[model samples]
Target: MPSQKLSTLEKVGFGAGDMALNVVISSMMLLITFFYTDIYGLKTTDLALLFVLVKVVGAIADLVMGQLTDRYTSKGGRYRPYLLWLAVPYGISVFFVFTTPDWQYSAKLIWAYSTYILMTVMTAGVGIPYISLVSALTNDPKERLSANGYRLFFAKIGAFMVTIIVPILAQKWGDGNPAVGYQAAMAVMAAMGIGLFLFCNFTTTERVVHVVEKQSLLAQLKVLLRNDQWLILCGVCVTGTVGYVVRGSVAIYYAKYYLGGDTETVAAFLSTGVIAAILSMVASTWITKFYCKVKLFRYTQIAVAAISAVIYFTVKPGDMALAFILYFLLSFVVDLHAPVFWSAIAETIDYGQVKTGKRVSGFAFGGISVCQKAGMAVAGGLVGILLSYFNYQPNLEQTQFALTGIALMFSVIPGFFHLVMGMLMFKYRISDDYYTEVKVQMRDSGYIAG
Candidate 1:
């Protein structure tokens, strides 16, 4: 069996990986839509197509990367090597995604597609292995949960940087050119991401190595499909991600237009949300110590839906203080599920191994990744379509219809998804006690090596 304890350093290192990954993730969630419209000048319809196609490509890449991880291992371990191998390319891809070329409109669209696809591919290159690393690091469910708390806490720190730093830096750097500012600012974040990945690789060690059975892709899928709990988590990933991306993608617009904010106010508003999420990480870690994580996950999301409705109905346009307060509360409760959700992935994988007698590690993680991407795809398309429907115009004073649409995207529409997410968790039954039983079974079955 894998060691149940991880040192603080190692936990921080593991956390750093997500922090690094969040450079891309947070940007995708928070800024990509805005950047495409305002900075890079892509039409909303073009953006819709691009988001859908790129995520489709990303889902495929996730699957391919999954298989590759299963087939490959080295002295640095199965998953950590990817951090070393792909760090530079990953950084470069992030830079390219934000780069604006002064080309023809069609050329710009092509560049957008090319760079975005490249970024997603590179993201899979590191992301699949990075997530799979959590299982490799420990077999203890509680340890996994604690480590995930660290991971998410740092992830939000990365997101906080994106929300607080990116806009400010872009505004300063671009100096009259927002595109140049975004490019320069993102280059710095990309570099930090590369460094953080390397730190994660160096500081963390994989102790729990699964004796994964060599199987065909179809066979692996069959095995994964049999895990009902895994399926539930898949649903959770999709719906939660859709809720997250939809709200996040619209936050800047909400802040700038609905709240009538300038650049600083916009940054503060987005920062408020990220800071609340950051605090939620700590709160979740502490709260789960005293309560049922599964229950917490279910209730917090439902609360999010309720609070979101309050925001929609109660907060009027330009009601900045009330908006910030409600949004902070909404953001806080909405993310309380994060640590539980990520840690539960490994638990479900363990449950799957115990149930199916087949250890489907890499592909299972990949499947979760794919679900997240699918959610992003759906959310991105929704944002684009909704923007078009509402006649959203970039850098222009929005029509009342468009402003209301932005408000709904930020609050009610995404909140409905969170409601679905919470209800789906009623089907998830993997408690800490149940996971302990799973561990005992795996140990007895000799599926896990001591």
Candidate 2:
């Protein structure tokens, strides 16, 4: 068997990859909608089309990147090379997405579409390989879990930066022009993203290289479809992501309009949620040592749904203190499933191999990415439609209808999806004990090295 242990430095390095990734992800979830509407001057209908089209393209890019990863291996390893090669491009794409050109409305829309799509493609280039790198790091499930814990912890740090730093910096830098401020602030973030990706590339090593079979994409997909556990994870990904994206997208609106907060208050509100998520990463790591990870995943999400309902019913507009407290609790509980969910992807791959006798790696990782994109698409569409329905007007006092819709988006509407996500986890069976058996079987059968 390959070495099951990862050094602290190596774990930190792996974590850095996700941190870099979250610079984009956190922005997409938290700031993109607000940026488009309030700062960038996109109409709700245009924003809806932009989100849907970009995600559709992103899904396709994920599949293509997956196939590319499976077909190629080099001195840099199967996944790390992408980080090195795409880091600059990825950073540039991020900068461009936030850059607002002084052009006509149609021209600006085209630019938005072009830059967003490019960023998504670049994300796929790095993202698929980064995720699949987990399987390559080690076959030991416990090590995978620990590494993922670190990964998620750092990912939250990256998100925290986006929430706390971006708005503050943008306001300061732009002075009078919010657009200029956003561009400058994101430029700093983009540079950090590139550096972190390079650090990840240099510090991590891949030990468990699978002997992948040569199969058509269609054939590999067929195999994956048959793996019920993986399918369940995909469903969980889609539903959970929808909830996450919806809540994140509306948080700024909730703070600004619903809570009657200014820029600093909005920043503080978003930072509170992210800080709670950061703590949840550590808490999940500790809790899983004794409690069943699967149970933790299920119950915390269920708790999130209940907390969300409480926030929706109890916290009226301008109830800043209650809103912050409930939001913190909701954020903490909702993310308890994250490390478990990521680590479970590697386990489900192993389970799929043992049951079907075919090793499917890249496409499986890619499929999860696709499911996440699909969730974002659904969430984005909903946000766009709901904003229009609520008669939301940018940078103004919202009508009661608009404020209520924003509140619902932040709480109840997304909570329903988390509820379904928790319920779906009930069918997932790959506990640590079960995964240990799958490992033994794979090794004994020579599907993996003995």
Candidate 1, 226-296: lDDT as tens digits: 99999999999999999999999999999999999999999999999999999999999999999999999
User: How much lDDT does each candidate structure score?
Assistant: 0.95, 0.95
TM-score of 1: 0.99
**Per-residue CA lDDT of candidate 2, range 304-418, in tens?**
8999999999999999999999999999999988999999998898899999999888899999999999999999999999999999999998999999899999999999999
Runs of candidate 1 exceeding 4 Å displacement: none
Q: Candidates' TM-scores? A: 0.99, 0.99
What are the RMSD figures for all models against the true structure? 0.8, 0.8
